[model samples]
Target: MKKEKLLMTPGPTMVPPAVLMAGGEPMIHHRTPEYSQLFRELNKNLKTIFQTQNPVLTFPAAGTGGLEAAVVNFFSPGDRVLCTSIGVFGDRVATIAKAFGLNVEKLTVPLGEAVDPRIIEEKLKEQNYKGVFVTHNETSTGAYNDIEAIGKITKNKDILLIVDAVSSLGGLDLKTDEWGVDVVITASQKALMAPPGLTFLSVSNKGWEAAQNSTSPKFYWDVIKARKAMEKPSPQNPYTPAVSLLRSVNKALELIIEEGLQEVFHRHSQLAKATRAAVEALGLKLFAAPQARSNVITSIKMPEGIDGEKVKKQMAEKYGVITAGGQEDLKGKILRIGHMGYVHEGDIIQTIAALEKALIDVGYPIEKAVGIKAALEVFN
Candidate 1:
């Protein structure tokens, strides 16, 4: 029999049993009234999770597709936009914008640090930008930006405040409407407690008006087309949707709602705090800055002379605890532990114990059970 392993990656986190069972159910016709009713209910719950009163649009694609959609639908070629970067995902937004012939101005901060809203405020004063792109949580470095602060800076301006909440939404508190974010993009994986395949975005009235004038070439990612299909008496996607994934997401949303959003966010916060404490007790340093740390994922720096990949490998092979390595420039230098989406106290304890053992196996000197003890103290 195959050994059971805990998935602790930044995305594609472990799914709940109910969510898995929902995905296994038999498929239904997308155009049928039954499916339409399911779709409508799903959209309503999504708005609650997003904390927005606007219509949320769903697409049959990954998180990157949502990013591309935001870029293609909001501005035309030659339009000036500000893309803020703190890690890989932040830079990805700028890459997509540049690919579409937009004049991109990148405002980047050091790795493992969150973007300072004051810099954005100062930049806005220098140029009349069409949009400002921000990543609520940078998964690579485990840095969390303050969307509320940035929103306050851009709310009254003519610029659109676009946010990539792929890893933050549903896991953190995001006031989409209250924060004045013009466009919010997220995926089904991550904190949604569902399988990958579907991506969703909530667009404000300003976003829609901007779309009307956008000349960027697009068809499959057209939000207007999606909105039209959804506006019908029987709501549906512009194209054939991911019925199984949608079913799983519906069940996942139900679980989140049942748990209560604030309680869920608190659980994530406690889990992250426990994980951070465990890492510190194990003599391992965290990668992200303290004030900017993310609750969904914790990035830890490799111990002196220890290989991050080896630590990750030993954790999975010897202990059946799967974790992720860093991306781009930080690869093999950092180990990321994800504690979001259906994760709990027991899971954190188990992972900390496994990590302690794995660190010892990889030639790092550390007392056994220290990490677990630290984590337990947090829970107690």
Candidate 2:
């Protein structure tokens, strides 16, 4: 017999059994009325999740693909944009912008700290940027930016506010329309409780105007074409769509609505609090700043003289619990535990117990059951 490993990574989070069963259902033809009805309903539900009245476009790509579509559809080659980078995903926005020939300026903060909106406001005043790129929740460092404040800064201006809500949407509260966000991008695999393969973006009216003027070369990622197709008698994608993933997302959205969006957000907050408390109880330090901590993922600093990779490996092999390590510059120095989507108190408690044992097994001094006891206290 083999042990079932608990997936605690930032992405590809555990999928609910209902969603899995939905994805396993018989496939429907994309051009048929059946599929079109399902697609339309999915988009409608997604608008509720995004808190927007705009059209939410779906693509057969990962979260990165949604990010690229946002860049190419809203800005031309020489447009000036400000990318406020706090971690790896935030920096990726800048990298993608530069790759597309945009004159990118970065307002970067330390790895685990969120970027200050005041600095961004001052920078915006100094330059006439065409757009601003920001990550709503940076999973790399477990930092959450103040998108509402940033949106207020760019809302009345001629600048477009594009957000990477890849890991945050469905897990956190994002008021897309009220916050004046022009474009919001997210994927299915995170808090949406679906498999990876599809990315969704909602474009405001201002975002549509920017798209009409954008001269960037695009075919598969063309939003206008997608929107046109979606508006037709039988809604469909510009290219082949992930029908199975769509079915799964439809089910996932149903579950979210049943639970109520506010309740879902509250659940994530409680889970994060419990996870953080458990980590601290095990004598570990959280990586993200207190005020900027995210409810999606929790990144912990690797204790002195303890190998982060060893801890992760031990958690998987010995305890059947999987965790993620840091990326890029912070690699081997931090560990990330995801508590989004289908996660609950039991999952968090199990992961913390596994982590406590893993730390002790990897030569770190930690008392047994301390982490689980702390987590239980939070749950109680």
Candidate 3:
């Protein structure tokens, strides 16, 4: 075998060995007292990762479901909400809001660019919207938006701020409450180093207040009912939870805490820098701007006349290094490399080496080990 298959996509990233082992442990009944104790402790650990004192509700859904929860629990039908989007995942927030009968106004920047907080501020000034939605890190384009600045604009004006931190939460730095973010949606799959079954949200006092006033119809994604369930004597979900995934997620969080959040952030930053340096060294341009680049993933533009999809296939099938291609309009135009969640410096080095081989195989000119050498410089 050339290599073991590695997950280098933005989500469903490579799960840590410890988390996988935790998942293999004997299952526990969801309603039992033992599960109650474990779930409660998991909730507390999640809060630490989220950096908020709010109730971090874990739902047995993907990150998009968490996005829907924000829409239904806070705004009423026909209520105007401004959505700031830079890429595919960012656009999903507005799509979900529209599905719930809310009037969605979008402020979109070109792909590979971050949403300007100033633009968001100006838009809010012109509208009487109930809330503003934005993604902290756009997985599709590898852009990281300025949540702190956007949060200031919304909170000071008393408008609800909803953030999708799915790709940013555990890998990058996010201060949910301090930034005045009323609602934050995240998933266990990306930076949390867990499987894809679990989604999480951090709801502030403002968010709960909106829940009380929300007239939008909601059932499984009901924040109020879920909170009530947690407030029960034993504390539980209204429905069956993904007990095994939760156990694995707790182990992942424990590993994160043991490494220290700051250290983890630094590690990702270093790896991300290395990736950018290596891509440039190979004569490829970066898709996202340097200032807006995310610590989670790196999007690289295919060299002129090079076939992006073919290169991606070669990497996965022959080299055993799985990566993601760009979405929608950018499909077959660029390639994405994820270094979030359980990624190491050596993993990055190997990925770059594989890309060098794949690029050559796809008829793009590149010197062997050129990217690896440049990446090592950044790591050192």
Candidate 4:
């Protein structure tokens, strides 16, 4: 079999060689003072990236685990929670809320659009809810909800604001404290550019209070236990962490700080712009509305009579490129081009070229070389 080419999918995306090395730098004991110091440093660096005065808790799980921690720790059975269902992850939030026996009310928009805060305000006025969940970047649809505005509406209200920022946390600007976000959850992959396994959650004082009231059954994901353990002078966890992954995470955060957050976001913006230009030049429609498109990923509508999955396969098998197909109800209706984390302008150009070939292979006609030309306008 041919060697698998580079990963240009949303995640686990391309890992920088340095971070990969860090992950492979010999496993260490999770209990020693050496590991404790490493954990402490990792926690401190995470706080800087999250821009939160509150503690940013780390776990040996994926982004979904972080979400579960937020739900199980802060909400009990019969707790009223409002979830926004705009895409796959949003629906996952609602599902988790239901599994925890919470009373869930989901406010939904179409796959490509964002939920309006005014609508949320109207719901808040009509009824009482203990918490609200919002996904900052809907990776499935490549739509980014306005969490800052949403938080503004929820401030001083009786609801806790939970955010799923897995794909957007480090790529985009998220000021957890200033935005009034009660709990912000993220993963080691995506913009963090680390291997999957580690999860991060920043909880506010209000979120902790909710946890005190919560009667949910949780041991592995118990925020209170993790918080207490983290506060120890040694800074170890109740459970063993993915030590190597955390090492990579520390280095990844270092890279983010070295480049500066603003410049990092700017790079993502330029790459997304170039990808959009290339796709539009090929006469493909974008799934996300202009205002709601995520800088991390761009979901494009599949042209009529084309198999989106076939395009993904062709790109991988034939062109040495990898791109993501749509999810859930959008399985064959769209294709997602991710430009987050380690994705640079050259990666965007190569993916566009592979996509053009795949499109033509699947019988969509387009002038040769036009897409790349349009994309170059952004790069040059």
| TM-score of each prediction | 0.99, 0.99, 0.98, 0.98
The count of residue-pair clashes in candidate 2 stands at 0
Cα-lDDT of candidate 2:
0.93
Best by lDDT: 1
Off by over 4 Å in 1: none
Off by over 4 Å in 4: 1-4
- lDDT digits (tens) for residues 1-380 of candidate 3: 25569899998999988999999889889889999988888988999999999999989999888998899999999999998899998788888888889999998898999988888878887878889898999988999998898888888776899999999988989999898999999999999989998899989998898899999888999988888888787889989989899999999999999999999999999999999999999999999987899999999999889878988999999888999998899989899999998999989988998899999998888899999999999988
- Candidate 4's displacement at residue 206, Å, is 0.7
What does candidate 3 score in Cα RMSD to the true structure? 1.1
Q: Which pairs clash inside model 2?
A: none
Rank by TM-score, descending? 1, 2, 3, 4
- What is the per-residue lDDT of model 2 for residues 1-380, given as tens digits with 9 covering 90 to 100? 99678999998989999999999998888888899999999988999999999999999999999999999999999999999898899889999999999999988999889888999889988999999999999999999999999889999999999999999999999999999999999999999989999999999999999999999999989999999998887788888889999999999999999999999999999999999999998889999999999999999999888889888899989999888998988888999999889999999989998898888898898899988888888889
lDDT tens per residue, model 4, 322-368 = 88999988998899988889878888888899999999999999987
Runs in model 3 with CA error above 4 Å? 1-3
Model 4 CA RMSD to the hidden true structure, in angstroms = 1.2
Least accurate 10 contiguous residues by lDDT in model 4: 1-10
Give the clashing pairs for model 4.
Answer: none
